[model samples]
Target: MKEAGATRTMKRAVNIRIESKQAEQTQTQQAKGELYEKNGAYYLRYAEPDGEMGQTTATVKWDETHIKVIRHGDVQSDLTFRSGVRTTGGFTLPQGRLEMEMYTHGIDRKLNEGLGSLAWSYDMYTGGAHVGRIRLRLMIEEDRSE
Candidate 1:
């Protein structure tokens, strides 16, 4: 781990694949962004189109045990997922705000050395109602120019 303020920045091609059971849909989005590491945590910053949210900037921060996703722009949400733990948070959208709970099944953090991936699966709930199971996978592209 580097010092608290020391950060290593690299241009990384990021691929995000999301699978939702309730919607019965699978979507894949790709973007090039800056990947930073500091204080033993990884941060991936990217921009993508989010339907009603227009263009949204997504910042993914994760350590070994937990992953928190924050989206800013037209929509906003802060969700924390950890293994063997149930976390609650609220999602803000154009329509309104909704309280949600996430029960993470597992979080696998494999980003090390040069390149790897992070994968997690969890169940989402809102207002005591079961939503769906969601699986998210993020892969960090290697820099071949080096």
Candidate 2:
């Protein structure tokens, strides 16, 4: 019984990791170009090698511990993607938030386009909660020119 319980717990943990990775991949494929905010709108621009360009709009929600964003637009051909990140570790001091950013580009599978990067940060709290905020960013650019 004890072994079975441990196995169940491990399975759940593995499932969470798989889900998180899937979410991260979805975000990476859908995020492209530069991010900007104007007035009350958030905008992103994506350019394809076929001379096609796209723009997206969405809202971002931020709290002391997490940041959630939802964007919708015709940034790609017949495809739409959504992504988010949440903090699991670290101390929450001074009420900080986690931020995640991702970017992607389509390129030929045999060539290199120099379009992959990731950035993450954690903000530690001053209180005794032993909690902190986590942030992650990822970008990928592919060469679509054949």
Q: Give lDDT tens digits, candidate 1, residues 58-144.
A: 888887678999988888888999998999887788889999999999987665642467788899999999988888877767545
lDDT of 2 by residue, 64-123 (tens): 222334444433112112223322322112344333222222111111121233233433
Candidate 1 Cα lDDT to native: 0.74
Listed in order, each prediction's TM-score against the native is 0.81, 0.22
Candidate 1: where is the Cα deviation over 4 Å? 1-24, 143-146
Q: Clashing residue pairs, candidate 1? A: none
* TM-score of candidate 2 on Cα atoms, chains taken together: 0.22
Give the whole-model CA lDDT for all candidates, comma-separated: 0.74, 0.28
Least accurate 10 contiguous residues by lDDT in model 2: 10-19
Mark the 10 consecutive residues where model 1 has the least summed lDDT.
13-22
